[model samples]
Target: MTDSRIAAESWETLRARHSAKWRRYPADVIPMHVAEMDYPVAAPIRAALGELVASSDMGYLGPMPEIAPAFTAFAESRWGWTPDTSNARLAPDVGVATVEFLRAHNVSRVIVTSPVYAGFWHWLEELGIDIVDVPLTSDFRLDISGIEREFANGVGHLLLCNPHNPLGRVFGRDELLALAEAADRHNAVVIADEIHAPLTYPGSDFVPYLSLGPAAERTGVLVTSTSKSWNLAGLKAAFILGHGDRGTELLKPLPEAMHWRSSILGAFSMSVAYRDGVEWLDSTLDTLAVARDHLASELKRLLPSAHLEMVPEAGYLAWVDVSGLNLGDRPWDRILEEARVSVVPGTELGPQYTQHIRINFATSPELITRALTQIAAL
Candidate 1:
């Protein structure tokens, strides 16, 4: 049996680190805010980084032909869908890749489903693109009809979050196919940010947008990385995957510096992670599953009024409706002040979600218990 506690890093060790998750709040505050996992780095990635540093091989990023094959292999093995590797391109991170993909396609306006990743709003704002929000259904599934309406109304692009953040809803193949068909009908483009696909829990199927066949290949562009899955965001490397003639044409306008700006260490480490990090990933998933269950049970026992609605099917983020707690319009502020437990305010994800809060359960069951206990006491 896999040791479910294997991924839990000691609080003492984690607290001493300089990452933003630890540093943003004071010593007294327990931060469950950031998306970063509290698990130790994967062995393959660590070894690769150590080897690179030991040889003093750090230099400008160059042709890393290994990235494409590694990603394709992982995709094939994990999802049974092999992407075309010839059109793969590198970028500093997912944000940069997304921004550049939008810019290259001359997309002036885009549709986003909320409550979505907070970064999506920041990215579009930076590009001066108009945002058309088609919020998900109350059940946290895609508003396919709403999305189709936006595309029909002349919104030519969409920024999608697969294995959605906060909600942790891994969209199904039927939903994605419906979306792909809608985009094809409207001559629209879909840029799928599949960063969380690898973290999807068992029983929830994560459908890759580009894997939906001809319509998807024509209308979809994929951007993903080892950063989210392997907890390597600070290392700064991600890739853009294009497919078919339309996909290939859309990527042609991306600047050459997009690849050059990527860190060599990040790129090489990402390759190593894709090629050799499966065992560690599987172990971490087991640990995460244990943590996720702990959060659900603790919340139900300690804070019954806090409605978890649906347990997350992927990743460690849990969206809770704290309206029942009567924490007011700004519940997160009250929680921060009283409980000293920091979590993401739902308003940051979408304005209508003021009564909600996003909790990161990527830490140990003990930390989850500690944080929930603090919040429940309020």
Candidate 2:
């Protein structure tokens, strides 16, 4: 097996790779804003894609029995929960699956926990739904009482981001159970985006929303993928999982196109990933655990004034409080222009978080060091 713990390619080689993370910025800039990792694809996944291409087997997607069982096996092994494979369906990606799920239910408004994934806002607005922001509490956990308040005001859908983006706090099991109770009492539906669940660090616990209990099973739907977990976003495929009979029935009316829209290559790779990508994933997680610590320590050493909102509990992104640096309204701009390090500006996350910047730290320790050093120099 290839060593997933090390980034084999140098900056010059990586810059020429075919991905937005490389092409979006100039060569001199360290592009650490996007979620794509710096590691190579898993050997099992690479071999699967290669064989498909070599045989000219690239065709439209069709039913593959392995999809559901593969995910079920992974979920059971990783999180100790097993989803009913019969409750799963395919979509082009998480975004499409989310919007389509909302549309199918005639949902016109959603309760969103903000300072969340920016794409949640985009997807809701594109569906012509009103978004009610229940921003994360100051500590970056779900504001359950605030969410309950919003639910009381007539919103039927809650768009949840588990193992949240940017801040990277993996929502705890008790919090999720309380949320499930609230949703059940208010008759609200939860559409959880669990795409980042697979990448959660060793000590963090990522509780699947649908696995909470009977109340949660009735009120929840999960949209997840190998895209974020396996760096297959460009390939375009994801799954929508309903908890039980009620939840499954709710998802049954989705347009047939949702299934057809998924890429054949993506579906094949996703199955391969869940089944055979565990070794690679374990190695990547080991590497990221080190990288995560390295980034945090480097930030303290180089930029003591800048505060990390929370050390990420999962994934590679770090949400930092750059307000202490006093670098104008948008600190990311200064960092990009002066430090030549591209990071996501806080404003894009939400109006309440304009003083922050989300940094992707899933790279070599050397690059993490350089990026922090540059920011400090600014």
Candidate 3:
């Protein structure tokens, strides 16, 4: 879990969701939406890219041996987990890795918690899997018993997000271990998308499920990436670390003709980001903490009638209750157009949460302040 009081910005995300209005706003008018950031990419990352560009080395690419240990170091430093490099395989993106894993396993049923990331299902449609949506308990933790029931007929997979998207809820060791236990019972794989792991509140703990003692061996936990915390989604590189030879099996069975796999640039970027960008990431986390708090406090003051989830842990997503605003079935759009701010709607995440608007708070302080004022007026 990230410290809520430290940083204040969800920039890249803000820009993406609010781009249309951002284009229309005056030079100073802030469009508080989207997940893209206003901050320049980290200096070290920029320098590394510059060095690569100077060499004019962009061309056809292949695997690099430097990625695993670098990421391993990051895991050890941040989460106290030592990833078994042998169990890891590279994937282009977390979402792709997830849906592909589901399909590869011949899975026809899925389980997920809502209000979740909007793109969670982008990879599942073609497979025609039975989608099982479960609302979180009032406390926002996944209901283990409920999940077990959903798996009564056998849930082939569970898409689990830590430092979860939209809600920003960071589960503790016990919380994640419970899910691992359930997955073990059903012999289902738990695809853990920990892309947001690196940005937790300072001093807060993040536990990778596999490290939760012995139950993980049969759990088939797959950690997607550390890119989100580093803001490298565009890099499209994630890793699958599976124990007991599962990762080897998955790679061997990798769709024979699938060539749009990990990219050279993506691998290079991840290696550099994980190995040398620690300080830069620390500062980014600080920025997000401040921005999320401001966004939360502002929403409370402006939309007092709305029920905002008090985020206990997680990323920069501010899930605000917008159902009371009288925008039936389209509250996210209603707020987007009316408030001139774009946000990931809860409806996209799941049907149970139609009234919530997930705001990306990782942006410039000024834009967040402006977006809040607009929402207040709306």
Candidate 4:
């Protein structure tokens, strides 16, 4: 039997967690919202963080020469793709990297595929950039023709979510290559958010935008972090990878403080995660796969009217359509009030998905069962 790396504590014990998922709701609420996992930090990452704290090594963050190489090894081993280290830079997180890269290129109007990671809206709004919404196809893949129309008309940037959040759709190489070609033809930059790439399941192919083709290498900027995969969001470390003159120039305006903003503990822990945490990661994946199927079965058995739009291709979040539940305007709000289960509101992704709710299933099967049962009973 494979050892499971992810296991959830009881509700009483989990209530003590200092994270937002636990603290945001009252004691009666079961949090199934936040992307962070309920699993304990990996032994390697915990050990790295512990050594830093013990030796009093905490100080202003400096260039860690190890991050690029460690990430290179992890990427190659896991994805069979090797990144160019010279083209990589560290930022506090993926949000910061996206904002700075757009600012560097003086991007005023950007296109986003909806529904998207909610944070993408905040990043664009803060920079005073106009948003052009290109909603995904009904099947939840990119609307390529829509993207081309937006790009040809004046949109200069596109924010892409690969192994997309909520939907968990791992985009294919052909689709990504077509996007890269469209961007290159229109001289538009594609900022690919690939943080969830590492979490993809066994058979799903996660094709990195940068590895798509020459057009992709020229037109895409890849930003990713260890936060999502290793459950280390609080650590605050991410990588910005670019290639050639276009890639390098787009990255040049990142402020010097970008590096300083990352925690020293985060930097080292990230390196350790990439270099030595593979065994733990594999174990975690196995657990998550079983949890994913378990949640689907539970939901199907309990709520026959509810629809899981896509059996997730990756990650623990499940985007469920509750349209059949007969819950009004804010179905998620009703779920929380009646069922006492906290889920991410569908409207956060976009106004069109008001009947949908996102559930974080990265917990013990018992918690998933409890949450689904409560919803079904309501």
For each candidate, how many residue pairs have backbone atoms clashing (under 3 Å)?
0, 0, 33, 0
Better-scoring candidate (TM-score), 1 or 2: 1
State which candidate, 2 or 3, has the greater TM-score.
Answer: 2
Q: Top TM-score: which candidate number?
A: 1
For model 1, the stretches where C-alpha displacement exceeds 4 angstroms are 1-5
- lDDT tens digits, residues 243-316, model 4? 87767777778787788888888888889989988888878889899899998999899888999888889888
Question: Which candidate leads in lDDT?
Answer: 1
User: What is the TM-score of each predicted model, taking all chains together?
Assistant: 0.98, 0.97, 0.89, 0.97
Task: Please give the lDDT score at residue 201 for candidate 3.
Answer: 79
lDDT comparison, 1 vs 4, better candidate = 1
lDDT of 3 by residue, 233-269 (tens): 6666777767656546655555532324766667777
Q: Ten-residue segment with the worst summed lDDT in candidate 1?
A: 1-10
As a whole number from 0 to 100, the lDDT of residue 97 in candidate 1 is 99
How many clashing pairs does model 4 include? Answer: 0
Task: Please state every model's RMSD to the true fold in angstroms.
Answer: 1.2, 1.5, 3.7, 1.3
Residue 267 CA displacement from its true place in model 3, Å: 1.0
Candidate 2, run of 10 with poorest lDDT: 1-10
The best-first sequence of candidates by TM-score reads: 1, 4, 2, 3
- Per-residue lDDT for 190-300 in model 1, tens only? 999999999988888888998999999989999999998899988899999879777679889999899999999999989998899888888889999999899999999
